[model samples]
Target: MIVVALRARSSWHKPAWWATAFGAIAVATYGILWATPVVLDGMLGGRNLLTLVRDAAAVAAVWFFHNAVAAQQRKPEKKLPAWGLGLAVLSFTVPFLLISRPGPTSSAFVLDRLDQFPVWLFSSIYIFIVGALAARAIALLSSEKTVMTRFYVLGLSLMLVGSIIELMYLAATHFGPTNPDFRESLYYVAERPFFGGIFITVLGFLWVYAVRVFWKHLARWTLRIDARHEGGEYLARSLATSSENGWSDRQLAVNSAVNIRDRLKIGTQALSRREHALFSGVEHLLSNHLERTPR
Candidate 1:
C-alpha cells in the first residue's frame, strides 16, 4: 500500500491512484479483523458494529479495484452512485442492528448468528456485491489479451469462485444443521480462495509495475544512444562539407572530427553494422577533406 501510495503521488488521476485507494481500504478491512472481536466489541459498545464497518470497507475496496481495472483498460468507470452504495449498506445494517445479538462479540460473528435471518441477509448482501463486482471485473479484463490482464482475470475469477462458495456456505448454514466443526471447516474453505485471489492479484500488479519500470529505463538508454549516434553523424558530415581555407579551419575540422569519433566510440556497442559502415565512410570523407584543406 505504501508503494502504491507513493506511485499515486504523481499520477493521482490515473488508475494507479485508484489501485492505491483499493489497497488502503483492503488494509483497513483486514485491520479490523486483526483488531479482533474483543477489542472491536469493546470499542463499538459490544454490538459487533465493526463487522458491518469491515464489510462496508471490503465492498468499497472491490469497487475501487474495479475502477482501477476499468481505467487501465480505457473503459468508462461505471460507479454505483453514493446513494446506491449507502442503500446497500443500510439494507444489511438496518437488519443487523434490528437483530438481537446478545453477549460479547464472537470472533466468528456470522457463524455464531447463523440461526438468525438478519445475519443471513447481511452475509448475502455482502457476497452479492463482491460477487457482482468480481464478475464485472472478470468480463472487463477478459477482453484484453495482455499478460497483465490475464493475471487480473485469473485473480478475479478466484475471488468470484470464493464468493460463490461463501454463498453456498451461507445457504447451508441457514438451512442445514449448525454443526460447529463442519461450519468452521466450510468457512475456512470459503476464505482460502479470497486469500489466494488477493495474493495473485497483488503479484500480478507488481509484475506489471516491474516490467514497466524496466522498459522505461531501457527506452531512456536507447534514446541517449540514438542521440549520440545522430550527433556523431551530424558533426562528421559538417566537418566533411567545410569549404573554409586556413590553418584555423583545418584545426577546427580536426577538433570536430575528433569529437565525432569520441561519440561514435562511446556508443559503439549500440551501433548497428550498417551504422558502423556509414561512420567508417564518414571518417574516410573527413580524412580526404583534411588532406585537401590549405595549411
Candidate 2:
C-alpha cells in the first residue's frame, strides 16, 4: 500500500495509479478502523459509526478500482452514479436512532436488524461489482501481456475468493441455522478463512496496482535510454570510419558526418544535459575530423 501511494504520487495523471492507490488505502484504513472500534465507538458516542464508515470506504475502494480497470482497457470513462455515492454518504450521515423494543429479542438484536439495510446494500453492491470485475479480468488474461494485466487478474481473483468467503459468513449469520451452538461453531470455523482471504487479496492487489503504475513508466524510460545509447554507438562508428579513411576520400567523410548527425538526433532529447554534452563533443569531433580531411 505504501508503494502504491508513492507510485500514485509520482504519476497523478494516470487513472490506474489513482484508483489503485485509493483502493489500497481504503482497505488499509478499514483494517485499522476495525481493530479498535470500541474505542472509536466511545469517542464517537456510538456503537458502530466506524463500522458504517468502514463499509462506505470499502464501497468507494471498489468503485475506484472499477474505474481504474476500465481506464486501462481504453474504454470510455463512465461517470459514477450519484445515487450510489449518495447511499454511501447516507450510510454515514443517517441518524443512529433507537426504537424501543417490546419483544423476546434483545435490544442488540433489534438494533442489528435495523442496521441490516445499509450494511447489506453496501455489501451486496461491493460483492457484485468486484465479482464481475474479477471475471472480466480473467477473460482479459488470455490476450493482454502487460505486467499490469497479469497482476490485475491475480489480484482480482484473490479478492473474489476472499469476497466469497466473506459472503458465506454473512449468509450463515443472516440465514443459516439459528441454533446458538451451531452459530458459535460456524463463527469459529469461518474466522481464519475470512480474515486470511482478505489479507491475501489486498496483498495481491497492492502488488498488481503498484507494479502497473511503476513498471509502465520504468519500461518507457529504459527504452528511451537504450535508443539514445544505440544512437551514440552509431555516432562513434561514423567518427571512427571517417578518421580511418583520412584525406583519401573527403566526400565520403562529409557524407559519414552528415549520417552521424542525423542518427545522433534520433533520441538526443531523451538524454540528460551531461549526456547531451557528450553528444555535442562527439559531433564537434566528427565535424573537425571531416574538415581536417582534404577535399
How high is each candidate's TM-score?
Answer: 0.65, 0.51
List lDDT for all candidates, in order. Answer: 0.68, 0.50
* Top TM-score hit: 1
The ten-residue window of minimal lDDT in model 1 covers: 241-250
lDDT of 2 by residue, 1-295 (tens): 6666565556666655655565555555334545554554445555444554555555555555565555556554453453765665454444322222222222133224433544444444555555555555466454687775665566666666666765566565655546656555655454454355445545666676555545444333333444444664654554456458752233343354444355445634344576456445444545654332111
- Quote the positional error of residue 125 for candidate 2 in Å: 5.9
Deviation of model 2 at 2, angstroms:
5.9
lDDT assessment of candidate 1: 0.68
lDDT of 1 by residue, 166-219 (tens): 998999989887788988888999989976886788788778777666544433
Candidate maximizing lDDT: 1
Clashing pairs in 2: none
Instruction: List the candidate 2 regions with Cα displacement exceeding 4 Å.
Output: 1-21, 24-36, 77-83, 88-151, 161-172, 175-177, 188-201, 209-295
Residue runs of model 1 more than 4 Å from their true location after superposition: 4-8, 12-16, 29-37, 77-84, 209-295
